[model samples]
Target chain A: MSRAWAVSVAMMVAALPAWAQDVGVVSTEQFESPRSGGIIVRVGGYKPLLDDEKALNGKTPFKDTFGDSSLLLVELELQRYFYQGIGTAGVGVSAGYGEKYAAAKLESGVDAAEQTALKVVPLGLNLFYKFDYAAFEWGIPLVPYGKLGLIYSPWWVTKGTDDEVVDGIPAKGGKWGWGATGGVSFLLDVLQPRFARDFDSGLGINHSYLFAEYTYSDVDNFGKPGFVLSSRRWMFGLALDY
Target chain B: MRLTFAVLLLFASTALGQTAPVVNFAVPGASQGTEIVVSKATCGDTRTVTWSRTGTLPCSSLVFWLSSDSNCSGDPGDGDLVLDSEEVPQNNTTTLSGTLELKMSDALAATPNLSCDTQATNKSYRVCASTKKQDSLLACDDTASGVGTPTIVFTLDPVAPLAPAVPTVTGLDSALSVSVTVPGDTSQMKVQVVELVQSGDDGGTPTAGAEKVSKVQTTDNTVFRMEGLENGKLYGVFAYAIDKAGNQSDPSTLATGEPIPSNGFYAAYREAGGQETGGCGAGGGGLALGAVVAALGFWMMSRRKLS
Candidate 1:
């Protein structure tokens, strides 16, 4: 055949949809993958917004104490998607932990070498609706999602001497109460195709996402009536969806 | 009556003008003079003086004396009289008289004995003799012999203090504890502690160029503590005593001490790699931002679903 015929044949092969092509190591799959039902584990850093907690953190070393303020946070979630009736919507349950610590050595006092820390754990269920336009043949790969959830977060003071108060809250026992959360996730696999590549056979991750979330947890004081142990925080983390 | 008057007058002149009796003092066989180390503290080791008459006149009694003043001009009246031996002169063929022993330690005793007082170290002492006789009326004689003569002069020298015993290391770790025995010879002295730098080859011996760590200001304190020392390093320690006069005693035997290992405090709190958990609690600003983003996401989702 002539060289012109060869070019035409190649063009035909490239034009065909991924499903009608032969199976190989590299397939012509675009953003046609499913958008829900996966396990996600994420770890990030967070800063609390409670006035008392903020005051205590501000006093951490060099601010009035001897050491700096730092907090560690982690989360794990399991989600399921229902695509038949409500477009692409998902429900997920997550458990997470956040700890903020500030240790200081008083220049002079009875409690010269005192350390204080606050730990909070949030466990909740949330509902999310994804805007995946590719399913309607719009040829868009982006999937932006919004979510709202209710959490019963338990918070306690980890390290402090008896009778010491951290940000107006008694740094002793823990309290569990109700709270709320709201956030949005942006699928990065649509922007970076490499994040969706399947390295192994069988069930594999199909998308990578980044999310920013806001949380407000209220752990009312078991003793003080007017005193409330409510706090707010901002968090950003990465998640993988299969 | 006139002859009797002349004889009484002669007797009165002899009694009134009786010349001072001559008294002699000597340390038998001690021609080079008496030498004594105050540290010996033994009375028998002291040099004793023998006295005899050197003039024609005879004294009824003789008294030996020791004084710190070189002149020895004052009798027992001068508080400088450190010792005295009062006795009748002995009758001998060589005109020998009484003997007096000088115990230097007695001069330095905490409680001095009568007739012999404690003598200060590093000083000169003179020995003399005085004679006393009763007058015709049996009253004490006013004129005494050897009032201005010092027969022998002895020097009091301090014995070198005993060196402190090799120190024993007690508490080791960042601080070194060493015990030094105050020299028995002196009670008012300062103890000096020296620390030797490790040459990386300190074979348990003090380095030639050792640096002084501290000086215990009080001799009463035998224990010394050296602080701010490097942990887990070898150091040689030695001590000496310094008297108020700046006399230094021999140094103690060298003692080697090594500090204990310290705990890794900073290492445990260093940065560690991995994901950190604990979500940030959202504030009003964070909530506002989240709501705006959520609204955009919801509107986009609704538009696509309707299409």
Candidate 2:
């Protein structure tokens, strides 16, 4: 019986190597989906420089009504990459909405029973470049980007329920200008590479990132003198590449 | 075993025959226990009551009555009013059904002693129904072998709610904002705006014109905006509250305001010689730009698929 037990142990030990080979437990190769475009959802504080118009001189009508607080702007941007060799180059379009409301004031300097609101819809078309080669090839997880864009902002002011009209001039207009933005994005795939590979294979999502950016915009109808919609703000949000 | 089965069958038959008839009542088209609110607006309406019964007891009639008592017990007292009687065919039917109409005017006339002036102290009555033998008259009494009586209540309300406080009026460009502090029991408020016509005589008070510009009603106590008035024109504002019973209160104290030209941010910019023509043209330009970008994105997506 002891001889039979020795033979059985030897046979089990010999099958272990074949079982390990079948499992194939150690592999670092990744199969990724094709990448073409990305979408970003961002929110930030935006305060238009309405009082900075040279035509306004010293009167701050926007400040007097809406105070110094900034409006919360929510924006969504869609990008399509045209080149993706060493770095990625793309054209992006963004749309955003922001509004501010306060109690309207009479000429007597007292708060009225009605509210006055300023609403704006900001639109943008941008050419952007992102340096993401290090994140993909060198195992680094940070991507830096830059954007130069044209901005068109439509603004309106309302007192009570109707648009304000002062001396036959209605309180609504649009401004056009240009802007430049710079941002840094942190890649989220490095923390769980296996899960990232699964995500790419199953959902066709190649990468995900959390990013923060600063924009310097001048949107006063290309300096023709109307409602100065220029603004400098910072935004933070998520980005998904598919 | 056969003898035991026969005894059990006889006992079950006796119990079924002795059971009281189960009676249920409802307002026709309404749920089982929905209360009928009788206000001045609905005082002339007729509400039909439907009753159904189920039992082995031999019943020949179904009678419905109204009582101020919650339990709907006892014979017809001074406070108890018999509504109507529905006669069923005396064929020993186990199930019976009928309907009776209760006129709100008659119910109100029945209570000449109680004041139905206000909803705060409103009067309520319960509807009851019972199945009885051919000659029996009283319903909802101890001697009746009927059970499962209805508990639907009818309330009478007639008076208007208290007037709201005086309104505070503010003037804007072509608009008037009216704010009223609503009373506790009020369910809604209405704001009325009228253009004030100035008198030609010197130092004469302006009179409100006959034509009203706007009449707005809201359930919330927030400020009401009356729009579409001429700028630089004086206007009169009035507010009133209404209760849930559809009764309107008296008009509040008059408040006056003048719609003047106010400068907003864009208006100020234009007044300062900022040359931006605002309207649908500028918005259309933005939309055109967005369409171009979207078209480019779709083209790129299709190109990638082709490759």
Candidate 3:
């Protein structure tokens, strides 16, 4: 009996908010991150580029990114939220897959280009500010997104190391790649589907969403996928707003 | 870790036991040498029969009734060749026999073979059995002339079994044969060989007859002789048996056998145990034994400087 009462009290406390309803915008023009009150699967791709410093594009293939040879990137991220668009930003961590161009030479802090498959697994923390729509008809309900984070990408298996040579990769598994992003999201409000009832809450209901965001990482000249072997990811994501 | 160990112990306890044969030899009331026997042995579902070898060679072969009856199989004579014989003055040898034999892989290895041989024969070596005898690491003694390249050495002294003062010779059923019969428990006694010597009519003794040409094997408790030698000449005969431990018993009382002399040969060569141990009968033993002392070294250090 005590356990049941304790659970009820805990749930009530969790529902409390630090702030009230929406005052930001009519429609959420923010990137509705993959994060939601409930978990949803997401998979997609993006073309990455350099943005940090001139070094991000120096020995990296970033300059050639606008062309057809930019890069093919794949990514996946999972997240869950607590409140309805007004709580701690549950930054979703993701691992990205892509292709990079390369040459047999150029071994340095950046030049060691690997023209092979490249993959990066990063643990990240995204701080997105959630905003709810005005409790009226046909208004917006989405997360006003803005993310500034860092990912520790260890080029542990970066090519050329297996060719039986001293990779001068002096620093083996290393530091993080700093990144910043922002975007908009569109939600799907009312779909009945099957076996489930659509909430007919007299007010505006939450819906499925679509979003695209721009990113920039300091993966300048890691491999041969391009000059900027590691870069920003332009992604399209689908999410649900509760 | 405890759970893992417990699981392993449980599995091990379930496996059945596999044991071999043990040998313990005895030659009762031995005046000179003792005997040995593999009293208790286990041939469980295996065709393993036990046999003993002489000298320091860990070359005893086990015989089994069927190939599946024993842990080891193949040529009975193909015992492990011992090398690097070492001699540690071991004066005691306690034999265990009954149901199962213990693992002796390390018990009597090449080093022990060498050491024991040295203490027993004053020599160390890697001994190998050959057609003639066995080869050893220790080269032969210079005075050991006429001694072939390979030599055979028994584990005990009194090379010959004790002699019976009033030994009897009977069971003779052939023209040139007679048997050496034991008085008491003949189970442990047997006839091995028949040595024949010829003496001239003169008061002087002559080194008798012809060369001793015997059969490949002398069966258990059975001895045979080829008589019908040059007649009119006196020939002496003796027979004996060897216990499991390679200890030979005393020969029966010498009797007379007169063979019709053919050609100039009037005598027959004596058949006896073939162990030609030099002075003190200590055979020369330690030979080639390599000792490897491998020492691997690794060093790691750490330094911290606060600036």
Output the number of the TM-score-best candidate: 2
What proportion of the true contacts does each candidate reproduce?
0.00, 0.31, 0.00
**Against the true structure, whose lDDT is highest?**
2
Candidate scoring better on DockQ of 1 and 3: 1
Model 2 per-residue lDDT tens digits across residues B1-307:
9999998888667555554566777777674246776667776677777777766344444446676665554444566667744544334474477776775566655655543333245667777664453223212233443354556777666777777788988777667777788886566788888767778869588776765765646566458877788877777887888765567888877778777656555554565565555663444676676677668656655665211
The CA lDDT at B213 in model 2 is: 67
User: What is the Å distance of residue A2 in model 1 from its true position?
Assistant: 30
Q: Which stretches of candidate 1 lie over 4 Å from their true place?
A: A1-36, A42-45, A49-70, A83-87, A104-111, A134-142, A160-182, A191-203, A216-229, B1-307
Q: Model 3, clash count? A: 74
How many pairs collide in each candidate, listed in order?
18, 0, 74
Query: In candidate 2, how many Å is residue B36 off?
Result: 4.4
Candidate lDDT (C-alpha), each: 0.51, 0.73, 0.33
- Candidate 2 TM-score restricted to chain A: 0.86
Q: Write the per-residue lDDT of candidate 1 for residues A7-81, one digit (tens) a residue.
A: 998888887766465454554264335444645666665443332332233322222221234356787766666
Q: What residue pairs are clashing in model 2?
A: none
